[model samples]
Target: MPAESDLCSLLALGPRPGRDAREGACNHGQVTADEVFFREWQARAAGETRSLARARALAEVLGVLPAGVPVLVVVGSKGKGTAATYASACLAAAGLRVGTVTSPGLRGNRDRIRVNGQAVSEAEFASLAERLERAIGSLPPRTGGYLAPTGLFTLSGVVQARERGADALVLEAGMGGLGDEVSLFRPEVVAITPIFSEHVGVLGDTPAAIATEKAGVVDALTRHVVSAPQTPAVAEALERTVEARTRKKGLVEYVEIADVPQEHLPPGLVQRAAQVGCSAALRLLEGEGLALPDAERLEAVLSTVVLPGRLSWHRVPGADTEVLADCAINGTGVAMALVTARERWANIDHVVLCLPDHKDLDGAIAALGALPVTFVRLPYERLRFTRPLPSSWEVIEAAELTPDRLAGLGRHVVALGTVYFIGQILDLVDADTTRLFTAP
Candidate 1:
């Protein structure tokens, strides 16, 4: 492995001179040697392809992922990470060691990769990062595309799972699933969550188009499939794609809103996702001829899983104030959060937004419906790349986000933004991020 100074030099290979250095990148600071190398590795994906080729190449070079492990790939616009986490918990309860890979870590970058519901240790991640760096450097100069951060993490998660003797793997695809790096693995079961219109230009213009792309995860290797209730257009697209991809023997079950009782799940979008994930786990186990757990046992296991930043309530550390935080990156997500808040809390006093400029501000405003709104001005240290805040919106300094000060702003507040922004709030409140998969 290269020395710290040598690895820092890799930052020079970042995006073009005029391009924003923070686009799909991390902030550079007094970080560890592994973090420095990983950030530079992520920079190499600038203007490169977002496909499986580069990820496959990296896996081949490292040759670490074990074969023949039953795999489950979860793909959708939202709730994918939660669904994958739920499925992993169920599999673990069934006595199989499971490895799970989700995106946008709640506490840090390494938390996105886990085994048996626990994040990889710092030492393990550092060692894996060093190995990945060496493999990436050894690749031929003519390699088609560079490995993105998500691809590298997914590959590392696979290696960690192998080292940990995991019996199964659950991978959550980033954004729309077609051509995603996770698709490189042949999954035994594929779970689809509700589809929403997102990444307009890059993925598709409409929900139907995005559904078609995401449905590509249901390849021939997928024997059984489960999907949350979707729009008419999305359902039609998914059915068509599944029919073409798999033989007539493949079974595709579309879960309905009625399928998940309100008594069994927490309020909001998690209900639909939990139903799909639980059903998928059941189907996968049944296919393997394993004895299914009793309904009570399954429910008990599912109840322990928590989805961070999805209308989750947090009490400020050393303060009496409590706030609801949601990782709503776009308009649709914000709308869902608002609906959840109204149904659960009845009245909302204030809404705080920490989103980037490229997000759907207009849609979010429309969904807010005249509610009092405050926009947080995050410093470059927290988020390196962001456009100027609008002059018309009320702005507050990120420094004033302490618990006592936040309570002074409003009695009932809802914090909404990207996963990173919500993660900041969780850290501010000292939430127990490590216990997300297990009961308190």
Candidate 2:
């Protein structure tokens, strides 16, 4: 294996993609080479239909399908990562080695791909990175754009999982399911979290339209699907899409808020993710004629799993403050985070927002409602404010938010923004994101 810096240089050898690509380099605080690769690949891919085609071609080159294990594809606007992680946990607890691939890694890029709760080692990642580059280079040119970074990472995870002998694979879709790279495989099970309006212009303008795109994950091979509670329009879209895809021969299960007993839940969006994830695992086991594991074991696994960046609390060294970071980019998500914060802590002294221009600022402000709190805005390249700054709010650069500054601000602070921004916060506080699930 090459030295860490050598691996970084080798990966960075290719031409930077997109216009003014250099400008897209890491603008946040110190980041690892893997993080740099993630941002660079994100800049390269457009996540369009053409990009999907390129990803499919790359898959063909790698020959990654007929995945010799039961595959689960988790898709939705939010909570997909949580749901996927839980499902992996349930499967692992039931005596199966599970691999999962999620987007926008919380701490490090390697965190996006894991098998049975442990991240792939740097040596393994570097080897696969070399193979992936060779395969992409060998592909014939086409009209499609660059393969999406999310798709590339998903493919890398698949390769890593297969090499590591994973018995099952769980995939969390990117922004949209149909166009996502993970849709390349025909999964045995598909899990749907709550569908809402997000990625408005790219996926579709409404919840139903976006749901339609997500529903595309239910290919002919899918025998079972479990969904969390969804709005009428979104549910209808899922129903129509599933019916057409399955030809009325498949089973669809819905998990309502009431369906999940409150006593077993861990609060906030985790409750919904737990409900949907367990349901999906149960359905998958039933389809395979495998006996369910001990209920206590499953519950224990669910209770212990740590989902970072979704109301996850971390303490900064040398600081009296504790940061509660959430990757809530929309109004509904922001509102849920606020509720969770209020319930977890008596008072939220400050609210820090690092939102993109396209985020629902007005709706987020409306949700904040009458709370006597200070608002801090931390701006990044992809997560900048759209309008003029508020006179009362304090604006800080990502580099300036150190332990000392954060401590002086307040004892309890809520950080809200895209996953990337939250990653910055996690990096700043040096949060432990190495583990997502644990084996029984």
Residue 168 displacement in candidate 2 (angstroms): 0.5
Model 2: per-residue Cα lDDT over 1-440, one tens digit each: 00111121222222222111324543333134344334334444343233667777778787787677889999997788888887888888788888889876665567878998777766766777777777877877645365556777789899888888888899988667777777888888999988876666667879999899888888878998889878888888898999898787435678874333467555676678777886787778778887777878776766778877888998877788888889887777788998888887899888877665677777777777655334444432333455664556666655566556666768888888766667766766777788877787
* Model 1: worst 10 consecutive residues (lDDT sum): 1-10
TM-score of each: 0.82, 0.85
Question: Over the stretch 13-69, how does candidate 1's per-residue lDDT look in tens digits?
Answer: 322111122133333421352353355345554344543665677788867443458
Report the lDDT of model 2 for residue 79.
82
| Worst 10 contiguous positions by lDDT, candidate 2 | 1-10
Candidate 2: where is the Cα deviation over 4 Å?
A: 1-50, 257-261, 369-384, 388-390
Question: Which candidate number has the best lDDT?
Answer: 2
Residue 118 accuracy (lDDT) in model 1: 86
